[model samples]
Target: MTDPASPARPVAAAIRYLSIIVGCACLLLAAVCFAIACQVFIQTGVFAQSYVMVGLISAALGLLALTLSRVWK
Candidate 1:
């Protein structure tokens, strides 16, 4: 059992909130990057693989963060 007045509790909650925020932001950024990649591909012959790679990495990280946040507590 944990104490309601513990200082660690507040810090942990803050970290969880921050993690959720970061996860959402990363997911949003990944979507934008993927959209841009598609536009770039359609306008030009280039595949824009770098943008796709970035999007994939961001998605993975975002999911991992969100999952870890839930699992932490």
Candidate 2:
């Protein structure tokens, strides 16, 4: 009943799931960075500049990874 041209469904699903996982991890990292920044700010009464910087860097890296993955595929 299967067509020869039909791709393997499981493989495609796995790839989609992997991409979602990677995206979620990136978002989680960003969230953690934000939390750290908030804590630092609350403790020191100064803007958590360094925390923000770290967050931005992490986000950029995540975005780069996602972009490359898509492009290479």
Candidate 3:
């Protein structure tokens, strides 16, 4: 006779794997956003001359979102 808990093992494993995949995706997206923002700053030079704070804020927000999504249960 099979243990009752054995039947649910596959489902649990699938959920865990899916969650990890989603977390990685979020992180990857955030990285891309950060890279783009850096490129824009470098190309425009406007941010450097004027509002450096805004660029920093945007980067921080992207990082926060990535962290939250990854840790979400």
What Cα-based lDDT does every candidate model obtain? 0.90, 0.75, 0.57
RMSD of each predicted structure: 0.9, 4.6, 6.5
Runs in model 2 lying further than 4 Å from the true structure: 1-8, 57-73
Write the residue-wise lDDT of candidate 2 on 1-73 in tens digits: 7665567656665676676578668867988998999998899988988878888887877776566557542
Model 3 whole-model lDDT (C-alpha atoms): 0.57
lDDT of 1 by residue, 1-73 (tens): 9888989988888889989998998899899989999999999979999999999999998998898789765
Q: Each prediction's TM-score against the native? A: 0.92, 0.57, 0.55
TM-score of 1: 0.92
Give the best candidate by lDDT.
1
* lDDT value for model 1: 0.90
Count of residue pairs whose backbone atoms collide, per candidate:
0, 0, 0
Estimate the TM-score for candidate 3: 0.55
Per-residue CA lDDT of candidate 3, range 29-50, in tens? 5566666667777898544422
